[model samples]
Target: MLSPGDTLSDFTLEGVDENGEINTFTLSELTDDAVAVLNVYVYDYSPVCTDQVCDISELEWLGINEDVNVVGISGDGPYSHQQFIEDNRIGYPLLCDTAEEIIEELGVLHEEKDGLRRVPQRSIFLIDSDRVVRWKWVAEDNWDEWDSGPIEALNDTISQIRA
Candidate 1:
């Protein structure tokens, strides 16, 4: 998996914007002039993934840090991401990685039991304005959620990084 201090390569993806419009975006554009929290998940509407995304959406620190951009990326397609956003009232953009290119590049790709399905291992990346990864968290298994408490712990980490 990508580690802290590693520079991220730029990649383009089609995603559901905060306004619910599907548009193509590049990593540089997303992180421009700000730090970004990239939440990489297995699937769009899965139980743990839903909890993780919602917790992030409800983060109080998000209101305080205008320079921090939080986005979720998953192997689901743009339509699925759009529906997930609308259904959950998610506040941030969610990127589609249908081709699995981004997840493979980040070393978080996972294959299902049937060996016909692939997805990302639940992961998070804190990338600075310069595209250097500042911090990261990768779940050991697909079911593993945040250990230090969900929203508050993640908020604290982002807070410390900004500080």
Candidate 2:
């Protein structure tokens, strides 16, 4: 896992824009915002994963922190991500890791189900403007069970940044 102050590697991924158009997004473009919470999930429809991403969207700090950005990522295709975002009314951006390149780059690709590729692990990375990892968390066994008090954790990280 990456630690605070570690520079994130340049990675490219395919995602769907708000207009539902296929687009390629690079790490550089992603970190161009103020702060980003990169939530990596296993699949689109999974229970735990959905809660993690959706609840994060409802985090109150995001509305107050103008410089904060958040994006959910999964190995699924853009079409699936698009529909999932729409159905769930996901307010933030979702990245379609169709090629699994970002997952591989982040060293989280898992070989589950004998031959199928599964999400490496459930984790969230807080990246700062300079592309340095500021904080992170990894779910033990299931993402749904992972809880650090969303608002509290986010508040702590943001407070640290402000200090």
Candidate 3:
């Protein structure tokens, strides 16, 4: 339930590299001087989640946005994430949160229908250099429509921040 202007908590997350090696990173360490496009999904290989993240990867401007970094996050382990990345041909990093620490910290984890804790909803957060969430999107159900509006809003916010 974090909102715009809310400062993010300290989080040390593991992200896999191109070679599928695990790399540890912290939120405070990575947020400085950068804009992050964060996608928190329910599972690694789920259809809706994969489509959402892969579509994000297809955003042409992301590769050229030197000030921005695109990262997808899930509670899955690094191995599963590695496979997902390779299968999906994801060009960006897939953050590993096997224990769902970040998800629980962000208050997104909830009781799922399958008897396990799944990220309650698909949400996106646009965090600016200062580590404040500038844009956010939340969906209650998998069928919820979340288009590129968050990205557009993020671009607008980034422009304003630079101005």
By lDDT, the best candidate is 1
lDDT of every model, 2 decimals:
0.83, 0.75, 0.77
RMSD of each: 1.9, 2.4, 2.1
In the range 19-138, model 3's lDDT, one tens digit per residue, is: 567788677666777777788887887877888888888887677877777788887788888888888888788888878877776667777777665564688887777788888877
The model with the greater lDDT, 2 or 3, is 3
| Top-scoring candidate (TM-score) | 1
* Candidate 2 lDDT, 136-159, residue by residue in tens: 776666544756575477668968
Off by over 4 Å in 1: 145-154
lDDT tens per residue, model 1, 1-163: 6788788899989999877999987889878887888889888889988988887888765667788888899878888988899999998999988898888988889787679977788888888878888778788888865454544555666678667
lDDT of 1 at 95: 92
TM-score of each: 0.89, 0.84, 0.87
- Estimate the lDDT of model 3: 0.77
TM-score, predicted candidate 2 vs. hidden true structure: 0.84
